[model samples]
Target chain A: MAKITGQVQMLFDLNKCLGCQTCTSACKTAWTDKDQGQEYMYWNNVETVPGRGYPKGWQTMGGGFKACTNQVDLSAPLPSINRDYGAPWEYNYDEVLTTEGGDATVGMLVPAPRPDAPNDYSSNWDEDVGAGAHPDAYYFYLPRICNHCSKPACVAACPRKAVYKREEDGIVLIDQDRCRGYRYCIKGCPYKKIYWNPIVKKSQKCIFCYPRLENEDPENPLAKNFCVTQCVGRIRWVAYAEDTTSNLYKLVNVWRVGLRLHPEFGTEPNTFYIPPLSPRVTNGTAPRIPTDLLAEMFGDNCSQTFEQRKARVEEVFAILEQERAKVAAGGTSELVDILTSYSESDRIQL
Target chain B: MPLWPKDTLTTGRSPRVLFVWGANYLNQAKGFLDVYQTLWPKLDLIVDLNFRMDTTALYADVVLPATSWFEMWNLNTTDLHSYIIPFTPVIPPQFGSRSDWQIWQGLADALANTGVVFQDSLPDGTTITRDYATLGTDFRTLNTDGQDLSDDKDACQFLLDSSVETNGLTMDGIAEQPARLLETSEEWTSDLLPNQAYYGFQRMTEHLKPLHTLTGRQQFYIDHDWYLSDFREELPVYKPPVDADLYPLRWITPHGRWSIHSTYRDLKFQLRMQRGRPIVYLSPSEAQARGLLDNDPVEVLNDHGSLVAHLCVSPRLPAGMALMYHGWESYMLKNNLDDTSGFKNGWQGPCTIRIKPTQLVGGYAQLKFRLNYWGPTGNQKDTRVQVVKYAGTLP
Candidate 1:
C-alpha cells in the first residue's frame, strides 16, 4: 500500500447526540439503499452505550492488531449475517391489509421473520437499554461509522491487496475488481463496520461520501458527508487531520478533550470522540460514570495500569469542569467555542 | 373554568363528524380509547382521508383514498424556521387515489346531485347560502376572494398568495428551494433576520414592541376573579401531582426516536431497529421487582384502561416510571387483553382526560378561544399506571 500523507478525521461530541438515527437514515438513503444485499447494513449507526452494540458483542470480537504492536491478527471470527446481524425481515403488508378482517381486528399483519434467518438481533437490538441501577442510571449515544484508520486492519488483512487507504486523503476503500470475496476484511475490522454483500459477493463499508468532498466545484455549498451534515444533534465535525487550524485538530491536540476509541487496537482511528461527561454529584467532586469503565474505554494505548488510566480520565473530567466554571464566570473559553461550532465553516473545514 | 387560566382544550365545540386527514388521532391521541368507547357511538359519522391504512382509517366508516405527500402539491411551514417549503408532486396519485382538494370537490358534486342546498349566516351579516345546482362550480371558484382552488396546485397557489409570510412566493421558486418568509405576521411575533437562528418573541424583546397582553408586557400574575377565587392560582406555582400517591409508576408517552409522532411508526425499515413491535420501557429495577424480563409482553393498566405491549428493560429510565414512546397503531397489538373475547385489538389506553377546571377560562386578554393558539394541551404525562407480565400469547 502507498504511504498515507494525511487523513480526514471526525470529532463526535457525545453530549449533543440525541440518538434520533437521522444520520443513520441519511447514510442509508444516500449509499446503501441502492444495493440488493445491503438491506440489513447500516453504514452509520447510533447505539446506546453500556449495552450490546450492533452485530452483538462487537467489542469482544477478536480482531485488529495485537496489543502494543503493529501486527494484524488474521485469525478472527466472522459475524453471522443471520445470528449476529439480523437479516432484514419484511412484513406481509399486502396479505394482511387485503385478507379478511384485514382491518387488523382478526387477520393480523404477521412479520415474516425469514425462516432461513433468525431475526433475533439487529444493528440496535438493545437500543437505549443501558447498564446501571435506578436513580443513578446512565447512558449516552455512540454513533459509529467506518473509522478510516491510519493503520486500518482491513487494509492489512486483505490477502488480495484489494483494500487500500488513499495516499491523498487516507480514505480506505476496497477495489471491487481486485476483491475476491474472501471475507477477511470483514473479520479484520474490530469495529465490525465492513459488511458482506451476498448478492454482489463482496464486502461493502462506508466511503465517507468522498465524491462530495472531492467535487472540484469550489462554489458547491453542500460539500460535507451526509452523516455530518444531516446530524440532527449537530454533534459532528470533519476536517483534514493535518489541518492545525481546524476545530478537529484543536479539540484533539490543544484542548486534549477528543479521545480515540480502543487505542490498544492500534488502528490509530481518525475518528476521535469528546467523551460524554457525567453530571457532578451533590458535592460536585466525583463523576457519575464509573472511572473504571471510562478508563477501560478511553485509557491510553501504552502499558498503563488501571489506576493510572482512571486517574488520567478523572483529570480530563476535571479540566472540563474547570473550563465550564471559567465560562460560567463570564470568561471566554476556546474549548467551548470549538466544541459548539456555531458556524458551518467551523464544523466542515475540508 | 377561569378567564385567565393556563392550558385547556382549545377547541370549544365538540366535533360530531370528524374528518381525520393525515393525522393518526386514533393511535396517538391521549384518552383516545375513552373517546372511542363513549363518544364514537353517538357520533354521526367519521370519515378519514389517507393514502395508507393508518389506525384512524381502520375505525373510520368511510376511508377516502387521498394522495400521498409525494403525490400532492402543498405548502409546508415550520415555527422553528422562517422558510416556506413547497411540496410538489413527484408522481401522480396512484391506484385511483385523489388529492384532498379533488376529494372535497367530488363530495360537493355528489351533494349537488342530491339537490341538497345548505346555507348559514356568517358573523359579519353575510350568508353562506349556496344553490345546490351550482354547488360544485361554486365550491371550486367562490372561496379565497373568487380564486379557483378545486385543484391541489391551484389551492397551494391560493394559500401561498393568501398568507402574508408567503404572499410573494411563487410555486416555481419554492419548488426550486425553500423561500424565507417575506415578513413576520401577528401570529409569529419575531423578526426573521437573515442568517440568524429563529427565536420566539424577537419583536417584543429586540425591537421593544408591545406584547399582546392587558398590561402590554409579560405578565407573571393574573388578577382575574377565577385566579384569586378559592382556587387561588394567581401566580404560577408547583402543585403536587394528584395521582402520584395512588399509583406507583408514572406512565409517560414521549415521541419515539424512530418516528415523528405516529408518522412512519409502522414502516418496516423503522420497526426493524426496534423490537418489531410496540414496547413499554421500564427501569431495570422496576422490571426486576415485577419479575419481568426484557422483551416480555406486559399489560399496563390504570383506572382509565389497559394496553398490552412488549416490555423493554432500560436503565435510561428512572425508577417509578413506565415510558412508552408514542406512535403505535391499535392494530400493532396482537394478543388483545380487553374485556371482549375472540380477537380484539389493544391500544394506547392508559391515559384519562384530567381537565383542570382552571383551564376552561375564556374572555381574558390573549386567553380567548383560538384553535391551538393558547389552550389546554392534551396533558398525558401525569397519567399513572401499573405494569404486570402478561401470561397470554405474543405477536
Candidate 2:
C-alpha cells in the first residue's frame, strides 16, 4: 500500500440519516447538470441497505483484491449501461394538458411511455424496501461516494494509467485527458462507482469536491466538503484522519465505533460507516435485521462490531438519561454539552 | 366558498358563468373536471387567469396569463415564521403576462368606462345608487400624491404602509436585506431572541385585551347554541376516525418536504429525486399479505374512487396505515388500465377516498361565519382504503 500524508476521511452515523437526499441534490446541482451525458451520474447517492442499490445488484458483482493474493483482479463483468444504470424517464405533461373533458370525466396525467429497452431500473430503485417482514422489518440508508481507498482497485486496473490518487489529500481521480475509455477501471472497481459517459467517451468518477477543499483558507475553521456540509441529516463528519482532535479521529481511532464498508475487499476504504442499531425484536432479544445478512455486508467481524456499537450506544443513552435527571434538578451535564455542539458553523472544520 | 362545489354545480341554480383567478381547480378541487363536463355548454364563459398553463387554464375558454413570482412585487408572511419576506421582481414579466393587481385594476378601468352602477340596501332598510366609477378612482389613488398604485411596486407599498404591523418597514429596506422582521409593538419585542421577533399572542396576555370569543376569555366550554343542539360538542372531545373500520388501511396524505403544497412539485431535479410518479407507502407485512412487491403498480381504492400508483414497501411505516406524500400534480399520476374508456377521470385516485363532513353547526358566538373558519373543514386524513396489485405495468 502506498503511504499518504494528511488524508481526509469521513464518518457517517447511520442512526441520524433521514434519507432526505439533500446531499445528493446539492452535488448534482453543483457538478453534473451541465452535461447531458452526466444525467445518470450521481457522485453522492444514498441507498437503503438490504436493497438493490442505485445500479441494481452492485454488491454481487466481483472485483477488488482477491482474498488470498490481495491483488486487483481486472476480470469482473463491466457494468452494463442498460441493465445496471437505468435511463432517466420523462413525464407526459403536453398530452395530459390537451385532453378534453366530458361530463363525469376528468383529464389524466402520467409519465411518458418508456422506450423499447429491456432495462427498466433507475437510481435508488428499491428505495425504502428493506428486508424482513412487518413489525420487525429493518433498513438504514447507506450514502456512498468514492471511498478514496489506500489501495484503489481502479488505479491498479487502469491499463492506460489514467487513474491516480493525489499524494496530498488521498483523493482518487481519473485523468479525463489521458483516459481512452478502456473501461478497465470500471471492471476493477468493486463498488461500481465509475461511470462510462458514452457521449464524452471517457471514464468519470467522484472528485470529492476537491476544488472547494483547495479554495479553503487554511486559517479558516469552518471549511468542509460539499456533501458533508450539505447533508440535511447532519450525519456526516469529515476531517483528516490523522488529526487527533477532529471528530473523525475521535470516532474512528479513539472511540473505535466506525467501520469501513466491505473491509474484506482489502482496499482499505477511507469512508467508514457507523452501523445501524435496530430495536429488539418482539419475539426474541435479537435485533430487527437478521445477523447473518449484516455479516455478509460488513464481513465476519460484524458480530464484534455490533457488540461494540451496542455498548457505545448504551453509554450515550445512559449519559442522556443522566443529563435529563440533572436538568430536571436545575443543573447541567458536560456530556450533554459535548453532544449538542452541532451548530452549522461548528459542524465541519478544516 | 365550498372547496368541491358539488351542490352548487349539480343544482344548476347558481350563476352559469365562472371566473377562476389563481387556483388550479382541475388539479386542486375534487371532482372539478366532472362538474366542468356536466355543465359544459350550459356554463359558458369560463375564464382563467394564471401564471402558468396549468390544468384549469388549459380547460378555460379565456386564459389570461399572470406574472410569475419572480416577475412581480409582493409581500409574503407565513403563520409559522416571523419574517416578512419581500418578492421583488428580478426580471420583467414575460410576454402577455401581468400582475394580478394590475389585471384587476384594468378590469375596474373598463367597468368605469362603460359607466357601471352599484345599488345595495343598508342595515336600516335604505337602498341608494352608488357611483361605481369611484371604485376605479379609489384603487388608482392608493399611492402617495395620487401616484399610480396599479403598479405592483406601489400596490405592495400601500400594503406595507397601511398595516400597523409593517408601518416602520419599507420595501427598500427589505430589498437590501430580505426576511427582515416587522417592527411590532413594544410588548411584543423579545430581548433574549431579538432576531426571531418572538411575539404572536402578546396583546392578549400582556395588554389584558379580550380574545375574539363569546366569553372574551380563554373559555374551554363553548356556549354556541349550534354546538349544543347540533354537534353536542360543548367542549373539546376526541372522535375516532369516521371510516376507520370500513377498510383495512388508513391513508395519510401529508405535505411533502419537496414542495409547499404543489408549488415546486414540477421542478425537474426535485421530481427526479422521487419515483417520477406518485407512490404509496405500505408496511412490509401488509405488502407481503397482498402478494405485492416493491415498485408494483397498485390500485388504492375506497367507495368513492380508485387511483393507481407504485407501491413502496417501507419498514418505517407501521401496519394498518398507508402514506402518500402530497403535492404531486394530477398529470404525474399513473393511469388505471382497468378503466375501459381510458378517460383519465380517476387521476387523483388516492385523494378520491370518501371524506367525512365535519359538523355543519354554525352562526352562533365563535361558530359564526368568518373567512377560513366556522365552515366545513375538509377531513383529508379521515379516509380508509384497500390496496390491490395493479395488473398493468408502470413506465
Predicted model with the maximum lDDT: 1
Interface RMSD of 1: 3.3
Return model 2's CA RMSD, one decimal: 5.2
Which residue pairs show collisions in model 1? B2-B361, B7-B376, B8-B375, B8-B376
The CA lDDT of each predicted structure is 0.79, 0.70
Q: State model 1's lDDT.
A: 0.79
Given candidate 1, what's the lDDT at residue B66?
Answer: 89
Model 1 interface CAPRI class: acceptable
**What lDDT does candidate 2 reach at residue A69?**
50
Error of 2 at B387 (Å): 3.9
Writing each residue's lDDT as its tens digit, candidate 1 over B1-395 gives 23322222464444478888878777666676666776677668889888878777777778899887788888778787888887789998899999888898998899889887678665555778767888888888876677677778888888888889888888988898777888888888798788887788899998899898878899878878787785789889887787542678998887678887777878887887777777899987899999998877788887677777878888778889999888777767664323374333445677776677666677798567676666666666678888998777655
**Can you give the DockQ of every candidate in the order shown?**
0.42, 0.30
Q: At residue B323, give the lDDT of candidate 1.
A: 92
Which docking band does candidate 2 fall into?
A: acceptable
Per-residue lDDT tens digits of candidate 2, residues A17-110? 8888888888888888888678888889888888888777877687788872558877767878767777666665655554355322244454
